[model samples]
Target: MSKVQAPELKKYMDKLLFVNLQGHRKVSGYLRGFDIFLNLVLDEAREEGTADKVECGTVVIRGNSVTSMELLAAR
Candidate 1:
């Protein structure tokens, strides 16, 4: 499979993104910034749990720990 390039994420800037991390953790937030390594900075981040969402103001996710990312509709 082709690798995800930084340029491909440009369109998602300032948009909501749902991120799947290793170990079944899931989070969603507005895209703030990123790097070639795929490390991401998200604003107003929130951890999604089975029953409720936990607020995480801002988070920087390590690239290697990311499993997948999905673009979400604007709120």
Candidate 2:
């Protein structure tokens, strides 16, 4: 059967997210904490590497201690 796509997904854009943290415990529940987490992550990623930054429709993070992260289109 063919799958139907959601409208929200259609408008989704890619983003390069970043987070700065030396230890693992520091980044725990970072995203759930507040808006700052999002900002921090995006900033860190840019510092780590030279990548294109864009708006992300959705952000999913795994692992407790996140040294860094880069957001991109989930293909």
**Cα deviation of 6 in candidate 2 (Å)?**
34
**Model 2 worst lDDT run, 10 consecutive residues:** 25-34
After TM-score superposition, the amount by which residue 17's alpha carbon in candidate 1 deviates from its true location, in angstroms, is 0.3
Go through the candidates in order and give the clash count of each.
Answer: 0, 5
> Which candidate gets the maximum lDDT versus the true structure?
1
The local lDDT score (0 to 100) that residue 8 gets in candidate 1 is 66
Worst 10 residues of 1 by lDDT: 3-12
List, residue by residue over 4-54, the lDDT tens digit for candidate 1: 666468888899999999999999999999999899999999999999999
Candidate 1: regions farther than 4 A off: 1-7
lDDT for each residue of candidate 2 in 1-75, tens digit (9 for 90 to 100): 987443232222333334544543222121222231223222222223235444343334333344654334342
Give the backbone clash total of model 1.
0
Question: Model 1: C-alpha RMSD to truth?
Answer: 3.4
lDDT of 1 at 40: 96
- Where does model 2 exceed 4 Å of error? 1-30, 33-51, 68-75
